[model samples]
Target: MPSEIKLVNVPALGKTAGYSHLAEVRGGRTIYLSGQIAVDAQGQSVGTGDFTAQARQVFENLRLGLESVGLTFNAVVKLTVFLTDMQYLPQFRAVRDEFVNTAQPPASSLVQVAALVRPELLIEVEAIAAAP
Candidate 1:
């Protein structure tokens, strides 16, 4: 982690499962990544009906996005997750933990929606990162 970034788990907010309560970044370049779905470079869907597969592909896309700007998952400070159904929460967490720094995970938000731009898409994830 960069010296300019700080991850905090607010005592008042109680324990967090896999994310921090707050992420503070000072003197760094902030990067905003668009929502990533389970799509490959050729614009083909990677996962059809499998939520876990889709979630993994989404994270992989985010990883590539971060790498494009000379950063890694460690530089990520926040994540916004959207799921077509809340039932996929457990699967999402499992996939997320494989990529993020769980010890000092980034602040995160999860929202359940009725559907995505594509019916086959089960999840979408956007991220914010800070790099010195």
Candidate 2:
């Protein structure tokens, strides 16, 4: 875990469903990753027309992006999630929890969009991470 980046779930904001309310970074290099969709390196969709599977794929994609910079999921401080449907919140959380650290969850935002770059894509996620 990177001490420069800390995640805090303040009480002022109600209970967190699976993310921290705030993530404060002390001093480190920050990386902003472009929104990652549910597509494999081969340019094929991993999970087509499936919210949960696509959500899982998105997290894995994020993980790989961070790993390229020698950072793990804990190094991530914030995540911006875009979903095609808001009703898939429960399913998305379930898959997100599998990749995100519950003890040091990242600050997050979920936005329901009318659609994504592709109709088959149900989820896209962008991440911010810090590395010392």
Candidate 3:
């Protein structure tokens, strides 16, 4: 393991799921990625109701974003997923499993929201990473 797991408390925010209110990983290289949507390099939506297509695009964007910082998906210690439709989660997860290491899934959170910057976009993902 590159870092120790930390439990962060935010009394004001209340409790979450199996995860802590927040997580802290000891340092190496840290990367903060902006939320990635289903948009392609040209900023066009890749998938409409097709969660798999959108998920693939999201991971591709994430991979490129990570490469820009000299890291990979394996370096990710945390991930936050925001979705306009919660019903698509199973589809997202199935596709997501193909991109990430199953043995060591990162600490993660999934949030369902009503909308995003664009109405056609259904999902957004962001990540935090630590690596040596």
Candidate 4:
């Protein structure tokens, strides 16, 4: 929706709920964001041991990063989410939904890991976006 990025969900699979199966990009400058953790401007952890709060902070951090480059969440074509616990997914989706467009969600993947750089950190998110 931010330009030529297109969301594609094949009929062969079940209809996607929160994310598109594929993102088709015609042409644009691709931006790859570094993994964003739930840290504030002061580099302080925003929500220690709280999955939902950490997720919200991560999205906010990502938003700021995108803004710095003259892009918005709408320009995002792909996202990768990392979590320490798999059970936090439903809660993460709830928070993520607030930031991302459901009608044209980006290609996404969620992975559960043993731990992050800090034990208190619960989640991390990174994105790939395209802009003209």
Among the numbered candidates, top lDDT falls to 1
Best-first order by lDDT:
1, 4, 2, 3
For the record, the alpha-carbon RMSD of candidate 1 to the native fold, in angstroms, is: 0.5
Candidate 1 vs 2: which has more lDDT: 1
C-alpha RMSD by candidate, in order:
0.5, 1.1, 4.3, 0.9
Q: What is the TM-score of each candidate against the true structure?
A: 0.98, 0.94, 0.80, 0.96
lDDT for each residue of candidate 3 in 1-132, tens digit (9 for 90 to 100): 454534455679885443345556765667889899989778889988787898889989999998988877777777899988889877888877877766556778899999988888888999987776
Error of 2 at 8 (Å): 1.2
lDDT for every model? 0.96, 0.88, 0.78, 0.91
User: Where is model 3 more than 4 Å wrong at Cα?
Assistant: 1-24
Whole-model lDDT, model 1: 0.96
lDDT of 1 at 117: 87
Residue 15 in model 2: shift from native, Å?
Answer: 1.6
- Measured by TM-score, how close is model 2 to the native structure? 0.94
lDDT of 4: 0.91
Best-to-worst order by TM-score is 1, 4, 2, 3
Residue-level error in angstroms, candidate 4, position 21: 0.6
